[model samples]
Target: MSLKTALRVIAWLLLAGLIFVTLSPIDLRPVSPAPVQLERAAALALIGFVFALAYPRHIWLVALVVLGSTVLLELLQLLSPSRHGRLIDVAVKLTGGGIGIAAGWLLWRWRPQR
Candidate 1:
């Protein structure tokens, strides 16, 4: 498969993992070295980076997906007895996503010209 296609697949996989992690019971989640908000930010940032690479021409769409997913996942968390949605987490996620998007743009720009 072309590199772009492979990257897209990887990006989707990452997204699926993110969803699973986001909705999982708090007690069942793996221990992290950082606070929950920081962890969430880091995960979303990585997600945004992969997605941006997968859709370089659609940066806005990538942004929407990252931010939208952040909100969607947090909302879904409301249904989990062990998880509660928080607006602060969403803000952190957005900040991380923006950072990732910027990184992706830089990567795309740095690619060798055909």
Candidate 2:
């Protein structure tokens, strides 16, 4: 598969995984060696980075979608008995995703045009 296609697949998979983990029972959530907040940030950041790379020409749209997704995912936690959404969590996720998006945008800018 082309790079863009591969990235798109990865991005979507990440999003699906996020949905599963966010909405599933607390016991079903994955454990990470990193701090909880860091793990959350890294996951969203990776999602944002892959998305930005996959659709470099639509970075702005991708940013909006990913950022929105971050908040929406957090908010969805409210529906789960074991999960609760918080503004601080959303803020952290947005920060991470923004950082990743900016990094991806810079990399795309630095690449030599074909």
Off by over 4 Å in 1: none
Model 2 residue 39 distance off true place after TM-score fit, in angstroms? 0.4
lDDT of each: 0.88, 0.90
Tens-digit lDDT track of model 1 for 3-102: 8999899889988998888899887777777997788778888989988899999999988888898899989999999998888888898899899888
TM-score of 2: 0.95
* Model 2, global lDDT: 0.90
Give the distance in Å from residue 107's predicted Cα in candidate 1 to where it truly belongs. 1.6
Count of clashes in candidate 1: 0
lDDT of 2 by residue, 68-98 (tens): 9888988899988899999999999999999
In model 2, pairs of residues that clash are none
The TM-score values for the models, in the order shown, are 0.91, 0.95
